[model samples]
Target: MSLPVVTPGETDTYEDPLDLINEIDELKKEKDASIMAHFYVDGDIQDVADYTGDSLKLARDCTQVTTGTIVFAGVHFMGESAKIMNPAKRVLIPDMLAGCSLADSCPADQLQVFQEQLRAEGRKFDTVAYINTTAAVKSLCDWIVTSGNAAEIIDRVPKDREILFVPDQHLGRYLMEVSGRKMILWPGSCMVHEVFSIQGLVRAKRNNPGSVVIAHPECPQNILEITDFIGGTEKMRQHVMSVKEPTTFLVATESAMIHAFQKSAPQHNFIPVPGIIASTGETCACNRCPHMARNTLQKVRDCLKNESPEIEWRDYFQQARAVLDKSLLK
Candidate 1:
């Protein structure tokens, strides 16, 4: 796929970044497009999105929207999900290279081999794929789920059936513990979520006493153990909003979500969990996903203006819908 062309070193040098937002809005209207952004994208992208939420929510919105085009302001898999939902609509992403590390972990061929081995062993099982996967990997699964509905969807599986949970071992473990159902887990992880330094988090907590710790289930066990609340993005926001008492929170997810939380609850303080300390004693910017950061206002404007970087779904993508439609939510 050809992406919008901007000269090297031109990403941050938009003549006026504010003007790009206006241009993007005009293009959206002219193209009859709606923007769907993930919570982890840049704050400016989120601000311009017609719908901004978790993966599942954005996919659902894509199916429901009457717009002829869907401009996804997040990562590549997210754009693919929107394409899966609306096969005929034009789906575009700001950056075609904005990929997910978790999605990269499970190749379709590897999953196919695993499934074949399971069947050869007389194991009849259902596969549950996290939404953070490639369209090809998702096509291989019986059901697709987000962290918010994973446990609920998994519970609906018959008690006698074995299950395979993929593309995020930490999330799989969390589901296994919560639902008390054992399953084979694919060893995959989000780089940003997995690198949070336990030492750094502990230190931050001690320094900011009385702060509640909120973490995504994708975090490691050590992070979860110290977490006051563990949930998906929307659920985390709801938890913070539900509490009337003003409280400080140490968040252990993508740094961009902190911006959303602060916007939702400006009265409360939200500090991101620092990454592992370098030899210089400085923490890495591990809380941010480099892929997510690939998106910028300049890219958005250029993609919308040119209408390039459109996602094209293969025939298998269409076939996958038959299996997906049989599962709960399409």
Candidate 2:
């Protein structure tokens, strides 16, 4: 497999960064709107966002904001999660089709049947839906969990109760390993997270001098063996931030995160790691989720200006929001 181009990234401003920041500020004053962006978004959107974070922070942050409109600058699942939390607030995203592959993999129809099957067996589960799933799926859940706080929130349930964790089998297995709880995990995974390879990463370490490896726990077990650090997006961000030495690190999650990583710790080095290869003559490398790329400045402006892109989940979804409400109190 060919090695991917990873870099100790740097930002280049277009015209002036101040002008864009000022425009967003002016818009905020006039419209009383808040822009929430994902770390994977382009630097301009990140710069303009009132808050930039992963799913956990994004959901929690929007719930706390008093704004009338929330312009979500990320994929479909994110915008839906925001709306699920802030139903009274007007929620919009730059792109309506900004869907997640992981969410797409677990359609509501199939999950509903799966739930019914569990019920048929005289079993009831305290459903813990991963934030990576669709709002429709979240509606079926008792509580929503993000990578940032899944384990903590899982412990909130009665230890004897059964759980059905949806949308990422690897993450579900990881949870089982750490939490020691048996969950009916749905067979789903993000293509990006599914690609990391342990052998390929070892080869990368040997080729790139002074390269430290970092990873997200959603990765398959083999790739995880080579990583120096493993955690959520914020944890990874903090890892680089707390380091004093100027060291190079190879990130094994989504490559887009490198932009934020370098921004926070400019002096430290960051490289994107390619995914592993399998015996089927396929190399797990150079994969980017198409949905996350849907966000752009122009679309964000349109959504906020018109407020036409409204979101709604089924009644069950809205009803399931009680679990999220309870989580907020925690």
Candidate 3:
């Protein structure tokens, strides 16, 4: 069943944020539910979540959830993922409208058409999709990967078969460089990551001397080129935590990601690299994903309390589940 979209502003009825938190806590117990939040969500939602992490971490962590209901405080694809993993439990998302641009870029039908075209030319290829894709898209893929595990999974693919990496061209390009694997890349990118300004990054570095720039691979080559360290969200956290000395980090991913970084290593300073509007060349805070911001404390409480907008098991999920198990579980 399709879920009704809930906006962040729609859940602003609560007078006290503390009261909403308490209500959500109480509702979780009453409904036998667990909330799994993505790190990209607001800090308040993350604080209230039973589990919080990057996509790969959350995908593995949700499988271990014993709750009767799972409220995913992220985007729609995440809700679908949780449901695919735990078909026995009910999976609910705070906002159905919280969609990923990367996922939307590669529709399942378009992928199928492209694969057919490649096959007609006698090209043998295996599809490797980022976990940000829809379940339908996942079913079409031979392997699923997140930024954290893409390199490892890419290594596992047979050397003979051509690789078709979808839905994030920047990441696909980066993987090709690191793994030395040539891939037919689907031209897609994360809306947030693609917008980060190279000019802003240079300015930030100049302003904060000795500050290290850590970027996600999803970022364009220009951004990743100037970065000191490049990795996924979990890896970024590990990189920062490993440094014993107090340091400033210019983060070149989603701005909300800085919340997790700050919480994990409060002693260190973290700055978000500003994005630029290409039309105007003005610096803006476009690094924050609008979809991730759609999830709110009020919506979490409402979803848990109502439990109407739940993710239903799909026939295609069985196919996707096999890929997820092979790609993520091992």
Candidate 4:
């Protein structure tokens, strides 16, 4: 789906980001809008957010907030999740086109067809969807898993049940390895996480001796195998906070995370691992998620001022929310 292109507000054009930031704050109060940002987005967006967190935490925050409208500085799925949980509240994404590669990798129709094929083969199918999936995909799955709680959730599933994990092959592989559970994995990967070069990573580690490697589960096994710790964004934040000795971290995730860490934990040094081919075919050697980067301070001000690109509620969203509520309540 093509998202609406939002430019700067006509009447409230700002000379700089600070000016835009001031307008955004005033607009949020005037419109009764609360902003929720994802950790992987620009730090400027994060700073203006009422709350900033990882996927699972952000979804929970969406449910708890009492605002009339929600402006999410994240991907399409993240905004959809907010709308799903809070059907009555208006939810708007800063950039409508901000999409996740992992979410796009698994289309809902294809996933439904795959499930049907498995059922026809006389198999009992239980599926776990990564939160990065669309509302339609979540509705089709038996349970949802985030990188932080995936292993814990998977361990609780009965050993007799056959499990299928979707939309993130790397995380699925990691879960299977840790839980000793054999399951079918969907062939999907995050474009940002797929770019880590083992050779370059080794060189980075060698250059900075005594540096600890913290990787996201979305990363390939080769990267995960050499990591000192692996978890979600929240866990990485916690690990960084708890370090007593001075430490330098080799972060194997999006470059935005390094910015977040630097702001919160200024004492620590962070070096993001470069992509195999650093050119990005357009920019410098920066490892950033293009989709997440689509959201800018200008877009945030424009979205809040106009509220033009609100998420449309659908029947399937209710079904997806039911699935999530059932698992979460259990």
Candidate 5:
């Protein structure tokens, strides 16, 4: 069965967003469902969510959910992770089409073929996958890492074994620099992160003097080079909250994350670093993930109320769960 696609601006149909929020709350109670929202989603969804965090935190949070159903208000990979961790519970994403570019970059079959090719060449390596992957890809991985715990997991890798990091070369490169361990990185990157213009970033920094730059490792090396701090969504929030004085921050991650920053530290100012179409050099608010935007309050309510687009458990999910347990749970 095909799920419904949330067209652009479908959310604007809601005459009163508060009414939608109330409807979602009622649906949650009626359906015995818990909503897990990522920091990158719109603030309305986060405010109504039962749990809100980055991928690593959300994975762990879902394991502790007592509800019979999970309505993931993030991208498709997040819904898959929730289902993998809690196979007993029904997992549904607001929009099944809401998928991560990083996950889409490395399909399971392609990754398998690449791994086999490496093995044939007598390259001994452990497959370390970033959490932004499909369940099928996760099943084939030796270890799964999120931005929050990636460095620690990398440090835990045996010194003798080579590491094959899949999906998100920018993150892989950053890991290499931080961990001092060279990795065979798959040439994949987040579309949003990849577009952040170095020119726009420099301009934002200059315009807002004394503004601290907080960037996600998923950004290109050029952007990371000039940033004042580098961390994941949750870590970025922590860093900003630690600052005692009022300050402006130029965020080099998804623009929606600024919502969380404002909520956490209302005294501070947050601005998204604009992105540019590499070919045209025209600046845009391209830092927001289109996938994340696919999720809407209407879709969330509809998914919970209907419960038709549930994430079915696959046989390979058992294998994925084992790695998720080891990497995120530990």
Candidate 6:
């Protein structure tokens, strides 16, 4: 049976995101459809989502919900994860093209070859993928991890065991630096988080005097080294909410987060660490991960109605399921 399609107002008549936001509740039956949005997306979208959370929290959510249709407002990687976990259910992304630079940094074939090499050396790894990765990557991984739980989760592996950490080299390095462990790290990165230049960071610190630098662990060590606090998107948001009497904060992550931070802690101030690479006098350069930006109220509506851009998990569920089961087997 075909799903009902709701036409979004693309014309001059509908100007408010709230209008589209409200329409979703009525269009998609409250019981059947649910939206899972990340902290980095537009605030209005987050506001409209059935549930809003950071990556790790959302990963856990895949177990809790029983929705027939899932519309993830985050990047392709995240939506793909939801689908991988819920193959029986329909998983849709507002924009199928919305992609993650971090996931794209390491190709599937290349990583598979590396895994083969490690096996040849008699080394076995328990793959723990970041939620920022693609379904294919997650499919290959033994378990999934978010920044909130990476440290705790990864720590469970044997001390002498060799592991391959994917995508964000900065976060990998940070984990290694903090834990004093050795794991082969893939040289992949997040385009948005990786763009905060060390030079510009210094300038911000110098100018802001009293402002403390708080960054995501995915940032380069040089950036994370001088930071006052280092954590994930949710951690950053909490720091802003819980902290008091801070004059200013230099946030070294996606600019979208500034909206929520400002809204929650109006007393303090924030500055988005400028992405020098995104605007280097180029003809066109926008650092916002195109994948994360593809979602809109209009796209969300289309996905609910047509289920047009559905994500499919490639491997047998038991394959990935076994890996997750083994790693999570306590």
- Report the number of the highest-lDDT candidate: 3
TM-score: model 1 vs. ground truth: 0.93
Candidate 4 Cα misplacement greater than 4 A, ranges: 1-14, 278-285
- The TM-score values for the models, in the order shown, are 0.93, 0.86, 0.96, 0.93, 0.96, 0.86
Per-residue lDDT tens digits for candidate 1, residues 219-283, read 99999999999999999998998888889999999998987898888878888999765457667
Determine which window of 10 residues in candidate 5 has minimal summed lDDT.
Answer: 1-10
Stretch of 10 with least lDDT, candidate 1: 1-10
> lDDT at 329 for candidate 1?
68
**Least well predicted 10-residue stretch by lDDT in candidate 3:** 1-10
Better of 3 and 4 by lDDT: 3
Q: Per-residue lDDT tens digits of candidate 4, residues 269-325?
A: 999886776564322236778898888888888899888688999889878998777
**Could you tell me the TM-score of candidate 6?**
0.86
lDDT: the better of candidates 5 and 6: 5
- RMSD per candidate (Å) reads 3.2, 5.6, 3.1, 3.6, 3.0, 5.0
Candidate order by TM-score, decreasing, is 3, 5, 1, 4, 2, 6
lDDT of 5: 0.90
Q: Please, what are the lDDT tens digits per residue for candidate 5 over residues 226-330?
A: 989999999999999999799999999998898899999999999889999777889986577889988878788889888968888889999999989998877
lDDT (Cα) of model 2: 0.78
**lDDT of residue 129 for candidate 2:** 81
lDDT for position 146 in model 5 = 91
lDDT winner between 4 and 5, please give it: 5
Can you rank all candidates by lDDT, best first?
Answer: 3, 5, 4, 1, 2, 6
Candidate number that wins on TM-score, 1 or 2: 1
Alpha carbon lDDT of residue 33, candidate 2? 92
